[model samples]
Target: MGKERDGAGQVRPTTSLSPSAEFPPLSAQDIETLRRLGEQWRVEKPARALPVDPELRPSRPGAARARGPDEAFRPDQPGELTATPAAERPDTSRGRFALRVRRVLLGPPLSSMSMLRERMRKLIALPVLSSDLLSSVAYGPEALLTILVLAGSAALGLSLPIAAALVVLMLAVGASYRQTVRAYPHGAGSYLVASDSIGPRAGLTAAVGLILDYVLTVSVSVAAGIAAITSALPALNPLSVPLSLAVIAALLAGNLRGIRVAGNIFAAPTYLFLVAIGGMTLFGLGQAVARGFTVIPPPPVPATEAISVLLIARAFASGATSMTGIEAVSNAIPALRPVEWRNARTLLTWMISILILLFVGLMLLTHLNGLVPRANETLLSQLAHRTFPHGPWYPIIQAATALVLLLAANTAYNDLPRLLYYMARDAYVPRRFLHMGDRLALTNGLVALSVAAAVILTAFRGRTQALIPLFAVGVFLAFTLSQVGMVNHWRRHRGSGWRRRAAINALGATLSAIVLVTAAITKFASGAWVVVVAVPTLVLLCLGIRRHYDRVRQAVSLHPTPTQLTSAERSEREMAQEFLPQRVHHLLVVPVARFDQAALRALAYVVSLGQPALAVHVSPEDQEADRLRDEWTAWGDHVRLETVVSPHREILEPLAQYIAQLRERQPDITLTVVIPEVVVNRPWQRFLHSQIERRLRRALRRLPGVVVTSMPIHLSEVHPQATR
Candidate 1:
């Protein structure tokens, strides 16, 4: 028999195969039979598994209990069969059993690398990818209004110019990404494109920016959604933080069900929101034009210092929020249907057209009417109320706006995990981030994003305005790097019409750089400084990770030893001199906390093994150690007893250091430690215990040539039958 680890890292046993009896794999059809057998017999626990319950043991069924020489029993569950050791069997304590039931409820474990493909059709792909892009309209135009109103009513007249400039920037970023979609075909987002063209440092810069962007997107979207709700229902405003957290929890659950299911649930809201906004814009404009385009009187401008070029650029920078989610489709090309890139690009085109239609229409209507941003109500909420004045359409538009804002994080939900997966594959993050949970979703990344967003939401007190300044800085930074990288890519490759493509990317790079600087300089005082400090710090960490991986590669490389290995290959070990000691000393030591059935069985098991065994007790002080010794003398076994003094009350490390000294003194002796654990019957009770056995094993496994084992004495375990 030998040891092997399953995909989940659980150790199990394997049997040697002969030529005549090759392993014929079991199929899904045989699963029920295996489960039935599992009910009849307990599985053979592998290394490090807790032992069976020792108290109130059940007598085996008569038929299966009596085995003949030729009768062979095969269990389809993992591990090979062997005679039961002196160690106890599985702890069927209600708590352990309850844990098994809870695991089953969560779902079956996916096979290693068994990634589920959710190739979405174009229809569903639109909402799954564009939720962030389309939902931004709820706040994008308002963001523009927010900046323009700062200079009072005269600056408000410049809304048309600001809106027009933002429109041009939006088109340039959209077209740049469309080219990126074709050039890469696979993910053409900043992380990949910058890595390819501008080197990995540039790529990591983009990666950090995108990570910040995704997390901030979730935070901002949720806050905006809460603003929508509170605007309509002022009474609920007091519960803003709790409401934001609840909505985030719901989104986390939806995404955990998988992207396809999430897309199906969230897609309808995008269409509905589009219709609401589209109808309001058309009717509002039509009514205005029909009444001879009569201008609504503007609010009075307040006296102030002159508006400088910096002030105007700051307004453009603020208006740039409208373009925040435009890069989502490009970043998520793989999430689309077959011919993924082509379908993704087509979907991108539709999203952009609709966005332009609704965004420009709202901008136009804002100019036609004397609308300004209000603290108590959203810009869209005001427009909706004004457009439909006391009708059903007003509430319908507001509801759709709220729903779309809530679902906007779905874009980050879809893309961030995929981004983290890419980062993990490149060794920049922990490997766990690459794993799919039982539900086949990137559960680690999903949960991590949710927690991060929730913290930010609470920290900012659920205010969208407080968080909005931190949004576009990360986005425009990525945009700048992606576009600049593409220019280098096109210039070097010189594909057909490469010069024209290069120029387009160059223009994008230039505009994005300007926006990036403006955003940093204008919003820096208003909290963009946090992002300014964060991106480089994250990039430096990435650099450190790359250095570590490089060092590990060099350490593990076999390139330096090909010739030395040839001489060592001829060296043979004499078993008598190498492994067989003159008189082998097998020392079994049981670590005891008190004298009970647990300690007795541990001692009795080593005695049953017919080895030289002793019981060692660790206590916080000499007084307690002496007391344990005196108690042992009264309730005595014939075995010798030892006491280990732990002055600091540290059980594992002191015992480990003592054992190391013992090993150094007697190099010939082999060490075996047996730990006795009480298995609890309730799910909650398991947490109440310290689980010292686990900590002991962790420490002992680090030592050379030591065997650590556990005997789990179940406090209470229901037998006869349990849910398999």
Candidate 2:
């Protein structure tokens, strides 16, 4: 046995050992560690020894005990005890009660610093930035092919060179936006830029176009994604529309739940798709370098050669479509971290890099594969078959390209709601869109996107190319307005060396504007006109809404009045007061067979106040009135009671007759007519209740020698907490 010191400091439990018989004392460091462990253990232990007041416990599973500086009080149930006079009522405590619980779950109220971090996190999650940006990869390629297809198979060779130009321009544009992100990291994308720069109408126009495009983005992206899935699984081919809608619903649910969760879910697939395409591009490039210049050959086409400059400009316009959702990032600056500018810039850089790689990769692959576009067909699908050898990889490449095509609208899905939120905050749209639900998700905006997308999908019948002409026109219109705004913004701040930058930006704006004109002219009949019309209509709608809000504000003006009440009018009020009894001993009120709680409470209160109560009943049918009189006959000896009957079954006539009789009998005595009413708690509840008090009050007002007192008593027990 080992020897140990007992609590009394005496040696105990001795065991023979060859080693040292006495143990050394713990070192200072070891003592500290043991002390820390003991403290931690104490802190983690249950609060069994702590004093617990029996009254502090919850009365039931769902019940909460009140807490206050004073002892908590529970009011007696209605009818269980008589109410004391108002003068004698107990004073209720004016502080919140303590709650008895093992733990409380809540973060400290957000400080500005915390808020700034949350904002940045939310900005990154904004679907518009990621989904919208990635989706561009899908259709940006398609847009390029659609244009090249018009110029002929040989002209399609120029696709890469043109794409190369666009790619350089995209990088320049991306760089320009980097400045925008830093400058206006507060959010409200192109609309803010346009409105402040160009004017309200232009800004509103941009907002409408962006909003419409956002809706289209969701529909197109989901449809494209579905189309890609269908290409891989022929069994799911016919279910594209329905499956697309289901995917939209799932996305809506995910987004509505929380932006963070949605971000986590969509980010991996989106990045994967990006990497997969990037790898395909690298593989195709490697093939070209190894195999030398051998064209993959093309599918059947109308012509073997290229097209005109007008057609080429139109194709460029189509290719420029990829830039549509770029503004969505600037619009969502408020959602970014405290360092919103940095985060947005980083996100933009990521976006721009991916966009360049995608644009170049697809164009190069298309040229190598010898793909040509028909007036209506997709070139990626056509090119995929030619570029990749006729093997298992052939189906894989086709499937991936198609998937990218379908998800291209992902950018819009993210962007539009953010646009809606800003517009709503400005009162250009419904205020509901700005509401963030319990999970801090833009639930309303998500729902709106889902519905609008479904409608567009149904309207277009999921034809991807059919929506393309209308698509880029809005994007370019927004871009032009944005560029113009930037130019003006810089000009205003000319003192800051922005004048030189302004001129260059103005040139960019002019070029963008010219491109916009070209896009509109070329695609007007093709479908861009629909967007042009739709955008203006949205502007008008927002303006109309603003006008309505203005009218309401104007109507509710609270300006102070200078005029005071005349002495004669004040004397009239004095005269009315003179007629009231100094001490009202008795009051009369009509009673029905089925008296509501308000009426009973009013009567009980009067009786409890040591005043005699009078009851008057009017019945169109004498028998019905007599029956009610009989019910209250037992209490008639304690108070004055009267019943008036009408042979013609008219309530008004009987009430008039009774009032006249009361005036003749007690001209000097106070005749206070008590009117009881049910108070509804909710707006919808008001519609379900009767408006009998209104009509009765009107009738009482006509009496010359009468005092009407509205006695509103508790009906359904409305707790003070309930009102709060």
Candidate 3:
């Protein structure tokens, strides 16, 4: 062996033919072939220079490129990558391995536009869609009687009256929504109808109301469920907030698996709740009527307060929560299987009938048995104890109640994302909200709703009553707006029996408006001001969202596609080109992690492109600055090193400022930033690597003309490249 000098006078090892065999001496042909193989590898080391063919062996699958290192990060379909890759994160890395585990628990990813087969038939859609409305019987009478008994026993008689009025409001709202299903079959909500008929301002206001209702529904239902859970298992009382969050997470996961799957998972609990409550109603009524509705009233009211018209109206509005989720069936018509409208209307009727019977019966039983609400425990718990006594069935009743209430949040999971999808299609929200998740469900919207609800539940300390006064406002607001929209629909299309339809909607609008005003006034001091502020604020946000989308459309809108460009225009090269970027100024900006073989290889790769390049160094102090300066000089000084001084020892900001200065100086140039990165085979080795390149790439991308690219180096053997 001997040493030879490279172009830079660096000594390299030279190989010669030789033989060394353990068992026997090798032949001359074998020795010659081995010598040639070693010489070929020595002649093609990438640290010195790229080979003639310039092919790179990447360390990771899908990181290798057939083109150039500059084009490795370029997306295959450039202009059409609006959806994020995380929604469909491949099972390739540790992060994706965790995602793969989560997917196993949450079910597989659903494809978009494949939800046609995922729709629910009547058998499946009934409990899936009606759980919220039916579950309200768990609290509807309690919210009313809690307010009625304020007169120290004189007010107890008014419970029946308030209950009757609420039932009427439920029927009116349900009938109006039923008509909504018939008129607007392609998914009708207050936002869609009010926008199409009553104008966009009314429509967006309705949208805000629907959003608030859905969010509050999730918070209230989950908190109430947790309350029931803690009541049954008193040991869990201290962990109420955490338990509420966990239940929300469970509901979120189930819904993300697609509607049919989630519906089946939730069906058993809903029917159990129905049987438990329905059985209690019959038992309490049968025993009460046997004794001719005789009851022992509570002793002298501890607190003496008079009841008036406003008090009765407030009580009425609060109890109307039974009707809170009645609009869900109509809002989710598109989610029904084939007979979308017919199945929806049928489910709407079944839900209302069940709601009225169960809710009204529960109210009457509370009247017959003389149970009153207190601050510490829910009235449903009180009724369940009275109906079942300390028996074998009591725990089952409580379990069923808790399960149904928590699953009630599935209503919002189903409707809110679908509604958000509509708004996104019209550019009223972020465009990504329009994407159907891998499971053909709205995963992003589901996550957003869950986070917001979890925050609200935490802030309120998981108390149901605290969230109760904040309810009813959004429900009645949406109800009123949807009714007004339907009135417009009847007037515009006067097809058949339009008079009856218009009058029905007009009546619903009047009744719901009265409830809206009553609820807002009664609960204003009890935290309803938040809703009052939120409604208009959300309306303005939606308006701002629309305005921003319009501006972006104006900014990015091409006057004409290439097909519209004339031959003269194409020849001029101004009006039309294939990609519309008339010129591309390749500016390679490399931020060196350290002056090593990887760094030099990346620099050589960029220099091969023959573009104006910048190599930036952000040093922590003078000593390190001097050290890097010497290191760069020792690496053969092919490109001038640009030193950026950082008095504050910042890494990304100074480099970002330098890039901004470059942009201001070269206003018409496209700047491409090239970064050097290393890939380690073992996943644990990645944690030891510096993340400076990632931070710099993120910060530099905000500039208009800047493009970020990466050149990867492998620490292990050269990996065979693979395509995604």
In terms of TM-score, the best-performing candidate is 3
lDDT of 2: 0.62
Indicate the TM-score of model 3: 0.78
Per lDDT, the best of the predicted structures is 3
Instruction: Write down the TM-score for model 1.
Output: 0.76
Q: List the residue pairs that clash in candidate 3.
A: 109-438, 110-438, 110-439
Task: At residue 234, give the lDDT of candidate 2.
Answer: 61
- Model 3 residue runs over 4 Å out of place are 1-96, 110-114, 229-236, 293-299, 388-393, 560-582, 585-595, 610-666, 678-691, 717-724
The residue pairs in collision within model 1 are 52-88, 52-89, 52-90, 95-681
lDDT of each: 0.77, 0.62, 0.77
**Residue 171, model 1: Cα distance from true site in angstroms:** 1.8
| Ranking according to lDDT, highest score first | 3, 1, 2
TM-score of each: 0.76, 0.65, 0.78
Residue range 1-724, candidate 3, lDDT tens digits: 1122221222334211111101123345446644544443332224555444223345477885444433333344534332334434654677778887877977765554466778888878888888788887787778877777777777888888888888888888889889888776767478777877787788788888888989999998888888888877878899999999999988998888888899989989999998988888898888888888897575456545578898798888878887778888867887888778788889999999999999889888887778888676778888888888867677888899999999998888888887777676566778667666667777788999999999999999998888888888887888899999889888988979999989989989998999899889989999888888899998889879888876675344334333445534553234323223324455777887567666777899989887787788888777888888898787677887888768888888988999889888987777887888777787787789777777787898888888888888887544345211
Off by over 4 Å in 2: 1-128, 304-306, 374-378, 382-410, 495-500, 557-724
Which one wins by TM-score: 1 or 2? 1
Tens digits of lDDT, candidate 2, 1-724 = 1122211223434221111211224545446645544443322234466465433457477876554444344346533432223322344332111111101221112222232334436433543366566566667677777766765566666677778767756765666566566555556667767776677688788888788777877776776666556555668766767877777776776565444445555555555566666777787788888889576776655663358788777777788876667776776665555566687888888888877877777777777767665433355555555556577665666555555444445555556767776666456778677665544555577788889889888787776677778777777777778777777777766657686666656665665676688788988998888887888788899989767755553333221112212434453234333323442335455444244466566677667655546766676777886676665664353445567777776665567568767777877555667776677655587678666666667777787667776767444574556334
